[model samples]
Target: MLILPILLAFQTAEGSGYKTNDFALLGSDGKKYTVKTLTKGKPVFLVNLYDMEGSQGIADLNRLSQMTMGKVRVVGLTTLSTRGRGLARVKELGVRFLVLGSDDPYSILDIVPRLVIKEAGSVSYLSNTLLLPDRRLTHVWEGYNRWTLKRMSQDALKYGHVRLKIDFSRFPEKLQRGYGEFYGLGPG
Candidate 1:
């Protein structure tokens, strides 16, 4: 058996403070809004999605949207061909929360640098970090796995309960798909 090393980064909970590293993303209304401003000291979940052929991103969005509501703000960032394509894709995927423009990759990249995976044949996007009230990264889910997403969302709810006013159970069933999806995630 080969011994594998485990890397861990210990991050503490942040207090009430906003920082400028905060980015502005184009909202569904075509308005530029600061994520920090929207979060407003509450934990924020930023997800970057790509719509090519696979449905992983859509599935993730669907489940996350169902599970999160008032518990934590979840934003969907997509990279479609055009404005119309991005907006249309958002609707087709059944995304309930606000979705930023395709050019907003920087916002998600700043939060999680390793979100994009460029392989020999294809590309895979990963990571969705939960920002604490004080603007620190509290939890990070490297990939769009259901179990990990559930735990991350659950952890966010728990953290929200201890910091801000939130309702975890109010999160929808589709959102909990990260916990367990009978249908396997789509192709990469």
Candidate 2:
């Protein structure tokens, strides 16, 4: 009993071990933004899409924008080159939040759909990544479900004025397993 509580307390204090990388991308609104600038000191929820043309992706972005408004900053990253039709599709979506075009060598396309949580410009958590080809879920992280959404909202409200700290151990067993797998502890 005491050991469990002690472990939870220690885990909470250690914080999530993910970090944000540096990159500047042009937004659909014709402005340039960086990951650090957009997230600033607040917690951010990022969704990376292979392209902006998918209706499901657009709907997800819109829904997330509304659900996280004023509580957590929501940003969309598109791996598709944002030159002609790609940029046009983003404009058509008319998403209220920021949508950035990524031209980085390691595009989101290489990986699956991901939900990244960042606090004070560093990644606090990275949710389970979904394999995009067949839409198969690898279950490697812990922020892509309804429970996580609610928890993130509550956390944002509670820690809006302070630096955020997430206790990963408090999450469900599945999430813990995913986290372990992501770090190569359990199974690959």
Clashes per model (N, Cα, C within 3 A): 6, 1
Instruction: Estimate, for each residue in 1-188, the C-alpha lDDT of model 2 and write its tens digit.
Output: 78766544312321233233455777766777665566665566555543544444345446666655655666666655565665777767776677667566235433232233222222213332312112222222333444444445454555454233444343343222112122113233
Number of the predicted model whose TM-score against the real structure is largest: 1
Instruction: At residue 178, give the lDDT of candidate 1.
Output: 21
**Model 1 clash tally?**
6
TM-score of 2: 0.53
Q: What value does the lDDT take at residue 120 in candidate 1?
A: 29
The per-residue C-alpha lDDT of model 2 at residue 101 equals 73
Q: The CA-based lDDT of model 1 is what?
A: 0.50
Q: Each candidate's root-mean-square deviation in Å?
A: 8.1, 10.9
Model 2: lDDT of residue 173 = 35
Q: What is the TM-score of each candidate against the true structure?
A: 0.59, 0.53
Question: What is the per-residue lDDT of model 1 for residues 1-188, given as tens digits with 9 covering 90 to 100?
Answer: 23222211211222223232555666665766675566776777766464423345555555565556666777655455325767766666666777665464334434333332222222234345566665555554434444445556566667655233333343442322122111123345
lDDT of each: 0.50, 0.46
lDDT, residue 89, candidate 1 = 68
